[model samples]
Target: MKKKKGDKTMKNLKKKLMYSIAVSTLLLGTTIGVFASWSGQINVQPPGWGGSVVSWSGVTKTSNSSKFAISGIKESNSLDPYAQLVNSNAAAKSSWCAIRQGQTTSVNDNTGVANYIYYTRCKTNNLEPNSNIISYSFNPY
Candidate 1:
């Protein structure tokens, strides 16, 4: 029994339509899967295995006669870190060195008190270790 030409053409068209639908579905699924796994935060860790500053509570100032206290948190403390204080009027620097990580520590005023105090968060350069400051504020108090 010979099949009619119109019936054969219709079957071919249906097969092509089914193939197109399957390919389209596969591509759409792939695109959606790729977008679903994205994370919003950038990695700022300094070539190490730890995360960047989780939170900063800001600098606090306290004064008692000639002595002053400046304190804050450096949550991801990986190296030699300090809370540094500078008096702009008197040209003096007071640094509280080797503070325990994630703890509130005070940098005392070794020199006489000045009109303004500049607080800085700094760490020793991992490569040089004792050479220079890794991070500090340009402005002083």
Candidate 2:
């Protein structure tokens, strides 16, 4: 028997509802999956690989005689593949630091640092490396 007009309309509405539900389910699943994957990728990062902060510890002081400490995890090591880059940079900038008494230039600067002598981390542009949050403590004398 031929379907009534009302039945046809009801059938169309049901089909539309089914399609809508399917699309919504797919979208919701995708969103959740993406968030889970991205969260993991963003949380813990390795050297040269971008990641979120894991942890931090450090210290600061206005005076050189004061005690201080800085800690952070870098994307890469300054000694990796860039040893020469670090050395060259150190040579270029050793002259600026007046760390030594009566030392005008960095002639005895065997530390192989550019612009600054920093262990565990250094940069040619003097930019602070991104890492996990940190805490610091020290004595001034």
CA lDDT of each candidate? Answer: 0.40, 0.29
Q: Could you say which candidate leads in lDDT?
A: 1
Off by over 4 Å in 1: 1-72, 89-91, 112-115, 125-141
Q: Model 2, 120: alpha-carbon shift in Å?
A: 19
Task: Put down candidate 1 lDDT per residue, 13-113, tens digits, no spaces.
Answer: 99999999999999998776444322121212233222112112222222233333323333243454443444433234564444343343444444533
Alpha carbon lDDT at 55, candidate 1: 14
The most accurate candidate by TM-score is 1
TM-score of each: 0.33, 0.31
Which digits, one per residue and each the tens of the lDDT, describe model 2 over residues 3-109?
79999899999999999999999999877643432101111222332221221121121223312222222223232111111121223312222111122111222
Worst 10 residues of 1 by lDDT: 48-57
